[model samples]
Target: MTAMSTVPWLTILGLIPLVGALFVAFVPGSAETAKRMALGFSLVTLVIGIIAATQFDVSSSAQFQLGEQHSWIPQFGVSYALGVDGIALVLILMALVLTPICLLAAWHDVPEEVGPRGGQRAKTYFALLLVLETFMVGVFAATDVFLFYVFFEAMLIPVYFLIGRFGGARRQYAAMKFLLFSLAGGLVMLVAVIALYLQGPGGTDGFLIERLTGLSIDPTTERLLFVGFFLAFAVKAPMVPFHTWLPDAATESTPATATLLVGVLDKVGTFGMIRFCLQLFPEASQWATPVVVVLAVISVIYGALLAIGQTDMMRLISYTSVSHFGFIVLGIFAFTSVGQGGSTLYMVNHGFSTAALFLFAAMLVRRHNSNSKRIGDYGGWQRVTPALAGIFLVAGLSGLALPGLSSFVSEFLVLVGSFSTQPVATVIATSGIILAALYILLMFNRVMTGPKPEELVAEGVTVDEGWRKSSGGTTVRDLTTRDKLVAAPLIAAFVVLGFLPNIALNFINPAVDKTLSYVQQAIPSLNPAGTAAEGSSK
Candidate 1:
């Protein structure tokens, strides 16, 4: 174990945004000042994250590296432990990469309809964003189960305000829905954590995840505990029936908030399943495999169908996340190394592609204030806003798992690996690939091709006009230099990861293998080294 005092960098990294949050909260008021402070603070955290990423020893034998641990509550056996295996490390990096971009993208998105409190409103908004960043980072870095839970619950405050204060017409309703759902999930999991703590050896406090993993529980007890955790995790994963809040929340919040919520924050749910569920409750996971896979396939197909039916751009993209998350869940329960690895890879790729897509949608909506989210309202946009259109095209194609993109690799690996274990579910999920293509192509055709709508015509939503000329009147301006700066990195990430995924896969594969290793003792058929990849119809 690494000394807590020697190199507590991950703790410092987590604190950077937290300190920034406190600073922004008291910094008087001014939109310009708020923006600068927010960007500056988030950048500091990003630097910390980058250093953490670079310092990580990929070739090391340890599953989790650069650890920092200190006893917090000796009686409870809880500690302030923080570390990242390959999986959590990548997510921390992703959150870092996206945070600043979201701040920059929201620069002009928040209107002055906020009244005299507008200045304070902007400052509060930025403060919440900063706080959210800290929790997001903390959740990924936490090595202790209790620490993970703290970060998990702490994240809701900023997001609640982000939606309630800064979102669309029904922001209040959306915010409450999000709050209730999250609170319910948390309450259920709290009980399970208590049970795990009580089951500690000699009742000596065993809240440490690594220690808890070694304890054996009866199959019935395991299933009960698993359900407690899985219900909370599944709702957060927003798998199938529990996913209703997502589309509404995404559509109402600003694009930047939506990007973080859908792209990085949502990944925590899937991450938890990977880290806690499959790792801690192996036998119960095996017993529940058939049911979980069925739900996963339903999420994939149901989300795709919902996405195809949505007219709102943000809502449409939100449904796509629901669908993508389904694939991740499916891969995890498939109980193969390939499936786990693919699920991890899916997290990274989806973060990039979905961030790009949401940002693009934000750009489009900003230009045309008309709530016309319908397909017919956005014909021939490629003619005037080619850069924006092009980015959207890349995002949309990636969303559908286009070949040579980051998603294609993960989705392919997931389906192939899952076939041997859950062949029927795998086959059904493959059809989702085709369905993804359908929805994405339809989205592209509706917004990019055909005759430009009269509203867009008036808004100067032309494909050929660059931002420099301002051809679409004052209302429909082209992509600003800031917009390019924000989106370029995300787009580049998608392309780069698509071709050289080993940069990420190398990190994910080991962590995924560790997770599978923990589970295979109870589920013997899940050995990854010998699994065949042929798609089975049985």
Candidate 2:
């Protein structure tokens, strides 16, 4: 075993964003000032996140690096701790990269009325955003279970304010609903955590995750406890029946906020499953595999069907995320190392792909000057706005898991890994691929083809007091330089990661394999594949 140092730099990195948020809130003059401060802070965090990523020892398998541990609440055996292996580290970095992009997008994306409201509100919003970032990073890095739980619960505050204050017509309703649901989940999880703590190796002590994983519990208790945790995660993952809040929340919130909500925040749920359900309650996860796999399969098909019927672009993307999450959950419960690793990678890939699509859609909505994102609203857009169409096409293709796109590799790995333990579910889930193609292609055809609408072709059309014109005096305008700058990194990442996934896989596989080994050790009979990988070298 490598003797890793216990230094919680990652937690410190998370805190930097909160500090930035405070700075923005207290020293703001105008909305633009507040926005700039937020952006600058996010960028600083990004730089720190990059430094942390660079320090990561990629060759290590499952052992956390740059780990820091110290006592926080000695009475309850809770401690301040943080670290990450490959999967968590990658996700954290992805969140860091996207946060700045979202801030930039929000510079003009948020409605003026819902914006800063001058000094105080603008400061508060930025403060909330910064706080949200801190919690998100903390959740990924925390090595202590109690610390993870605290961060997990703490994350909802900023998101609540973000959606409630700056969302669409139904901002208040949607924000409240988002808060209530997540809080309910968190409360349930809190009880489960407390129960686990009380029954830990030494009663009323040790909430360190690694230490607790060594404690023994019977199958029944384990399964029950797993459900407590799983219910919380399922709601957060917004899996199927528990997903009602997602469509409305995404539809009503500003695009930039939705990007964080969907891209990074939702990931916390899936991340928890990997950390808690599989690692700490391995036997229970094995026992509950069938139920989880079935639900995951249903979410896949159901989310796609619902997405096809949606008129709101934001809502449609939200449903697509529900579907994508299904695939991730399926991979997790399949119990193969490949499946687990693929699930982890898919989580990262989906974050990027969805962020690109949502941001582009925001641009479209801005250009059109209408709340309606109906496919029929525009036509022959490719001829008028080639850049917009091109970016949309790239994003759509990525969503459908097109060959050489990043999603394709992760989706393929997930399906392959899932095939062994869940052949029936895997086969059914594979149909989601076809459905994905149909919906994505249909969206493209509706938006990019056919005759250009007469109204859209009119130049200098008055929109909310501003004169707006489509490109070439006969069609919609092409993507501006700013749009190109925003989208270039996203598209390039999709291509680079798509072709050479080894960059991510090198970091992910070891941790995934380690997790699988832990699960199998706890439930030897469930090793259906009979592979002798328990002792295999990474």
Give lDDT per model, in order: 0.81, 0.81
lDDT tens string, model 1, 1-538?
A: 2223257778887788878877777867677787898899889888877886788876676667778777788777778888888999888888998999999888876655466666666777877888888889889888777778888888888899899989999999998999888889988988887886766563233566777784679788888888888988887888988888898888889888999998998998999998888888888888888889989999999999998998877888899988999999999998887887888889889998899888887787666545445666677777767778888898889889898988998898888778878898999889899889988889888888876544443333444222222344433556777878888898788788889888888888767777777887667766655643321210
Model 2 lDDT per residue over 244-310, tens place: 9998888888888898999999999999999898888988887888889989999999999988887
- Stretch of 10 with least lDDT, candidate 1: 460-469
Q: Which stretches in model 2 have alpha-carbon errors above 4 Å?
A: 1-7, 111-123, 203-205, 457-476, 528-538
Which 10-residue span in candidate 2 carries the lowest summed lDDT? 458-467
In angstroms, the error of model 1 at 520 is 1.8
TM-score of 2: 0.93
In angstroms, the error of model 1 at 473 is: 6.4
